[model samples]
Target: MRYIASQIGRSIRIVALSLPLADARDVSQWLGCNANASFNFHPSVRPLPLSLHIQGFNISHAASRFAAMTKPIYNAVVRHAGSKPCAVFVPSRRWARLLAADLLALAAAQKRPGRFLHARPDLVQPFLKRLSDKVRNYVIPAQNRVPSY
Candidate 1:
């Protein structure tokens, strides 16, 4: 991410609301900028709520907390982001499959039809397609780097 930012030029303006303070500071340090560097485009820093903390799919604590919520993850996501595309990140192939199954179970129960995109779809089995017909088996990975403007 810092490499991509440097390519555009130094001093990237970041809105790190979705990031923990450690992550925010790391990003700043990697970019050769002071952590206190502020940009007018940035919103005042505030703590993110639980729902946005889904980056680690294999985290039993996070998953369990999410599971215990009165609103299912699927419903909360669909409600908060109504029809908009949503992205959930998971580390590793095993966690990806497990998280996919958990999400699909919820979606299936709700009878929600949606597309599943895989950067390396060939790596997954045919069973994944059964979850959704509009699945894109292969897609070039999107650049997740923060931009400097």
Candidate 2:
């Protein structure tokens, strides 16, 4: 969308909205916006205040870094998501599976074993059975467990 907008002639005025970016001035220049028209606001300047948490680990290994983050991720979700749906984004499918298993284990250890599982497995079982063996092996056992939430 930005590429297409950038290609538009300057005769047609272009108005764009985006998250606060480090290179916003360059982006404005690329879009043919003059200094007076281009507005670059700090990330903290927002109508609705947003909270962002960034955590870094000193671990050099990729696998070790990911493993170290599992507990922190689980803690953040439990702290912030209070009865609301939450989503966790990971770097790869393998990491996603590993994190999901780790999160489940963490929840279990906290005495909330089914915290992340679906409340109604009967409704989800048919779809689960339809999945291929590779996916089923990773998902079935987790789905079979009762969901307390």
Task: Note the Cα lDDT for every prediction shown.
Answer: 0.47, 0.70
Off by over 4 Å in 1: 1-23, 30-71, 91-93, 114-149
Cα lDDT tens digits, model 2, 55-91, are 6789999988998999999898888775556667688
Candidate 2: list runs displaced more than 4 Å.
1-51, 130-149
Question: Over all chains combined, what TM-score does candidate 2 have?
Answer: 0.53
Candidate 1 lDDT, 10-35, residue by residue in tens: 55555454433435556566656674
Q: How far is candidate 1 from the true structure (C-alpha RMSD, Å)?
A: 13.1
Candidates' RMSD to native: 13.1, 6.9
| Most accurate candidate by TM-score | 2
C-alpha-based local distance difference test score of model 2: 0.70
